[model samples]
Target: MISINDLTFLIGSRALYDEANWHIKPGDRVGLIGANGTGKSTLLKIIVGEYAPTSGTVSMSKDLKIGYLNQDLLSYDSHLPILNVAMEAFERQNQLQKEIDELLKQMETDYSDDILQKLSNKQEEFSALDGYNIEYKTNEVLAGLGFSTEDQLRPLNTFSGGWRMRVMLAKILLQDPDILLLDEPTNHMDLPSIKWLETYLQSFEGAIVIVSHDRYFLDKIVNRIVESRKGKLTSYAGNYSFYLEEKALRSEIQRGEFKNQQAKIKQEERLIERFKAKASKAKMAQSRIKALDKLERVEDVDDDNPTVNFSFKFTKTSGRHVVRLENVTKSYPNVDILDNAEATIEKGDKIALIGANGKGKSTLLRIIAGTETFKGKVETGHNVTTTFFAQHQLESLHLDNSILEELQAFAPKHSDTELRSLLGCFLFTGDDVFKKIRVLSGGEKSRVALAKSLTTDSNFLILDEPTNHLDIQSVNILIQALQQYEGTFISVSHDRYFLDSVANKIWFIEEEKIKEYPGTYAEFEVWNSKRVIPPSKSIPVVPTKKEEKKPVNTNADNKQQLKKLNQDLSKLESLIEELEKAIKEKEAEMADPEIFNNQDKLSLINNAYISDKSALEKAQQDWETLAEEIMNLEA
Candidate 1:
């Protein structure tokens, strides 16, 4: 167990954490959540003892062991194969065994008391650490993380940055420290690998604190949520979904408290004002004034929402068929990644590609974008303009160029005013637009790349891990824009919530094959659940007590109710459209040039504008409610 008491950290004069307290029990599984730069990573470092806190104490049991995994990795030598390097985690165990072997040989040769005693103690320590099963367990973890048998001999240098991180993760898991401090452990992992990690962590005999933006992963793995905000810490019980609901409830309670305090202060002030105006009640007025002076004001809590935003609107539409691949095969020198994989992309299709790490998801994206070659038929649609955003697309930007120059290069024909306005849409202000590309942070670089992509007229977009460094607000904006887009999109991303919001189809790459499903993400989950379960070929299976008590639904009755609701929504949409058209016509008449010159005409137009806007907003809200009902009915 670890305890963080009165912890405070500062960057120059800015306080990142102030007098915050948090503790991790023996079986705690915590998901750390906060906006960018709120010190989630810093807290992890403090817990791991990598950084000394500016103030306060981090107390832990003596002889405690802790492991930390960072996003950036140091170079791992590839001279030895990947498996050999990963197996180094058991070095101590291996050393103990080697000594044990020598001790046994010496015991047979010379019967010295000291040598005999040493051999016995060495064997005992080795057995205590499960030294006999170290190799098997290490290999198991490596394979679970998606390393092929043949890849075990491949040099560590041959692996890419993502694969190197996977190797690091395997080593950390093999170490099995008393506490695991992971910052974005799922960032580079694919679906299968992520699931494997979740299973491993769920059974791990240690406390874990994970800082990640992946909602699905948190929902599956974490049992508690710790939010770092406004230099303070707030704890919530249960998983990410439970945290969301609990945080909302807490905010509601705080809002009610704030309102009540404000009302009380106002009432007291009114009474004091009336008494002060009368000479007869001057003493009472003085007493009331003193009470008012001593009264404590209620400070409203700050809004915790992050202000990250993105607006990506394409200017054209692609052909009916955007891309098609048949009989695709990809392999490295020692291993085959994809075997006879085939996929297709049609216009207006929001597709999400998923699979385990090293399962050819990225390889397939590269093949489609024509960056990597494959033995396959890749036919791009006619008049198709493709915009490919790779995982490290931000690094591909010219560092020498200023942010403004980078946008200008992408859209040279646009005037300065137009370019500046476009930059503003991506959250770049006046001076930020002038900053050098090399000077910006990773999050800023990602935003720049996104803004650059939006300036083009491409109708076909292929993105790989596009939301890596983005905050939640930016993700929402991007999701909204993609929903409004009229072109084709094929993305490989680990952000489950983003995929659920934008993707309409699921393309799974598994077992060296590609599988496609037509429906929303929730529908895909249901299908996947069924597919993963093996059919019963046994003699018999008795029903559980809980299952026997549950009532089976009548499908016929549900279908009739859904059909009726859909019909009603169709009628409401038509009525709202007619009212919107009438309002638009009335507003256009008041905007005439002669009327604009008259003050009275301007006043009339302004009043009409407000009324029309209010009506439109109300109608939109109603339509949204009906749309949700229709979605539920369809589901």
Candidate 2:
């Protein structure tokens, strides 16, 4: 419905878009993706006519209606009831209703044929406009966006900015515009609300352009991916996952073509140099030189995937029992958060605390951090130093201090050089480290806060929505950092990709208690949706008459089986010992100066070592199985 033709936009001296063309046709579910400051949101605004392109046209029909949900909409304030606010989207229906009500009032007093005819006409128009069902549709959208029945009657101004944005989202959804431009819609949404929005968008007839860092949401909603990169819009005819694989393949092809072109250019350069001096070949050389000069060089792909290589500063290891909560009870004025809940956090556990909003996920994090009041026994294990990172803590950052200075103050033991190196892993390097915290953006501040949290000499970490306000790349960096962390942690986040990447266990609050699923977020999602009983649970089967007549074990048979188990265990133990010894000997050879110097010999020895290690593991497993069987027989 919208055509961006040769679009070029400039922010001062920077070209945000250069000859970028994208046609957002009807029913096109386009995911607009890019790193922060790449102008994805700006492109949406240009398409919606809020901003004009510097060089080209964003063409669409005059009849085409566009609904844009953006950060700027958070400034919208109203004292009107939320339902009324949302119902405003049905302007024609509401207007028709007003006329119908006026005609009804007139007919009550006059009851003439003219008045009756007018009333009938107005009622027909109102019915045709679906005025009677507008409120129902509005209420459904509001509820899907997480408004309770009572909340529908509440004033819009009473809601927080995030919730207000949701109200705006409900309004836009009620409009049923020809196209929807959503910029980070999931940022203000909880997982459930996000899911509801996803389902709603799936059946929506109009086109959608979503700029989101939530890869899971993008993968579920977008049928096409339009990546904003290097001042151009590149189209991918698939979702986010497909775009990733396709991009990698294209990058590889581009890399090869670039190398081949470079080699060809070098050959042409040599030929020109060799023949330019000869009178017979000078014309051909000149022609070749002109062709080379006019050649359009392929821009090299800058595929820099920065990873978090910095380590968490550890003063001491936490005990096996990181934290224990016994009979914990926490409540607000009218809401009971957790009542008599018990949970344990053990060392080396990476737990993701997740659920719908107002479920006390953050409150539980604070209770663990010992920063909130509750009726419970919360015991911190020995040497379990904790570092808590939350979005609210971002405000605790010293605005006057530079990014480097903030880190220096938080980690006084570390030198400025070490702090700068740590910040480099968070993507702050050189002059960026000197930027004052006040001048930093939300994402920048989040990176600094995360860097500070990681550098604290604490073995137990508590993070509340740490992935909030961070882009995909920053989230990936955090994921890498958490994956490498050896200590215990409980993080509250709605970012499914982050949770799946960093969490080994999932925790969700249910029935005023903390419930845990010992699996990744993706695994939990599958089991949760299916309510699948794990394979570990035994299914009892009644024995048939034929099965009931099976032979029973006698003393002699049991003794013979026990003896055989013991003999097999002993043999397996001996084999395991021998394999271990052989592996050590191979490793010793690998470490030798002679073998290490010879790559071929080292490869052979390493392969042998790996084989021995695998055999040792199998032998050990067999020994354990045999020993268990022997013990069972004796019992």
Candidate 3:
């Protein structure tokens, strides 16, 4: 539906994209992936005609409708309720409705058949455009995005910045434009809201071009990855994981080519040097010298790997029992914010606290971090070290201090050089390090907060919505870095992919109660699925591939086979649940004290349990095999 041909963009003297050729077909769900400052958002703006390219052309179908969601726009305000804001997408339909209403009113005075016929025709057109379902669709999207029924009637001013973004999303979805250009669409969405978006996008009719940092979302939704690097566009026919794997392979190949070119250039120079020293081989020497001069030197591309590699060396050891909240209760008149809540953060625990907005998720984080006091016990671990990063952590930084100076103040032990190096990882390069903290953008401020957090040698990290304002690549790098750190962390993040990556346990905060689920994201998904449907009906069928092995080919058959394998893998997930149940039952039987007391009974139960456990292990391994196959299919 849209095409970008030989597109070039320049910011001052620096090139953002040069001869970048790309296009979106009618139903293409392409994900624009790149590191921060790589012009993903800029490209989207160019496509939507918000900004003109320095050269080349961006063309689209004459009647193509484009819906572009910029990261941060001017806040919308009106006396109408939130629902009305969404309903604006269907303005044509609304106009038709207004005409019908007027027609009905005039029916008492003018009994003309022609007027009634026109009214009937307009009503039909409106109905065909799904005008009747406008209210229902508006409510569906709002509720899916975590807006309460009462919230639908509330004015836009009543909502926070994040909530305002949700309102924007609802309107965009309602528009159903031909091409959807989303910039960090999931930045403010909670897990459930993100899931809703995933499903919505999956079934979306028109083309989708998204620039998001959520890996899981990209992996699940996007079929293609378009990367912006070194003022060029590179396309990969797969998801985010495939892009990573292929990019690594391409990097290795480039490194090899670069080395070979350097070797050849040196070899030519050596021949020239030898010939210059001898009279007999003067002609050959001059030829070699000319060849060396004529050699077009390869411009080596710098490997832009911005991975934060920092470790916290705790100054003091914390007791086994960290911060403990016993019967902690907080209320504001009629509303019970936190009702008799109890939670604990032990040593070396990585916890993810999540809940809907206005559900006290941040309030609880504050109460635990000792930023706010509660009615009950807020016992701290013995000699415990804690560092809390609230959502507004950037605002907490000293505005007068430069980026480097701010880091130095918070992390006094680090030298100027060390502080600059740390800031560089967060993309604060050259004079950016010298910029005053107050002058930085929202994204820059977020990076500063992250840099400052790493400076502390605290064993426990308490972060609230740390992923906010960060692009997808930054979030993934942060997730990867945090996963390796040996520290107890309690983070409140709306990024589901981030939580899935780093968190080993989930602390779901709902109805003023904390529920702990001990498992990875996949396991949690299985448990959640069971809660929705009956065990018998939930059985997933695993289909075995017809062939023992398949040859590597880029033929249509290969694609079809991959699709079939993915379908089969989806079917086989139910077997995992069955095996899990058996394993649990066996463990329970082996745990019985009476069975342990009798030698014969103990042996029988132990043997049966061990056999069952082994079988379960094999099934789990097979499931992994199927999962990898599905991953390849996606790739």
- Per-candidate TM-score against the hidden true structure: 0.74, 0.81, 0.80
The parts of candidate 1 lying over 4 Å away from their true place are 72-92, 101-113, 263-313, 326-342, 404-434, 510-514, 532-635
lDDT by candidate, in order shown: 0.77, 0.84, 0.78
The alpha-carbon RMSD values of the candidates against the true structure, listed in the order shown, are 24.0, 21.6, 17.7
Provide the clashing-pair count of each candidate structure. 3, 0, 6
Error of 2 at 304 (Å): 4.0
Clashing pairs in 3: 213-472, 540-571, 540-574, 541-571, 541-572, 542-572
* Weakest lDDT window of 10 consecutive positions for candidate 3: 532-541
lDDT of 2: 0.84
Q: What is the C-alpha lDDT profile of model 2 across 1-635, one tens digit per residue?
A: 78889999999999999999999889999999887778988988888788988998888899998899999998999999999999989988878767756765675688798976776676667556766456667767887888876799999999999999999999998898999999989886889999999999999999999999999999999999999988999999999999999999999999998999999999999999999999999999999999999999976778556765556678799889999999999999978899999999988999999988888998999999999999979999999999999887888999999998898888888778778877776668789899999998887888889889987888989998888777787788788888889888999887999999999999988878889999999999988874422121112111111112228877987776667666666777777778888977986785575664344686577656655665665566556555665666686
Per-residue alpha-carbon lDDT of model 1 for 158-201, expressed as tens digits? Answer: 88877888888898888888988898888767777888899999
| Lowest lDDT 10-residue stretch of candidate 2 | 536-545
Best by lDDT: 2
Candidate 3, superposed: residue stretches over 4 Å from native = 276-301, 307-310, 332-335, 532-635
Ranking 2 against 3 by TM-score, winner: 2
Pairs clashing in candidate 1? 78-156, 78-157, 308-474
Residue 265, model 2: lDDT of 96
TM-score result, candidate 3: 0.80
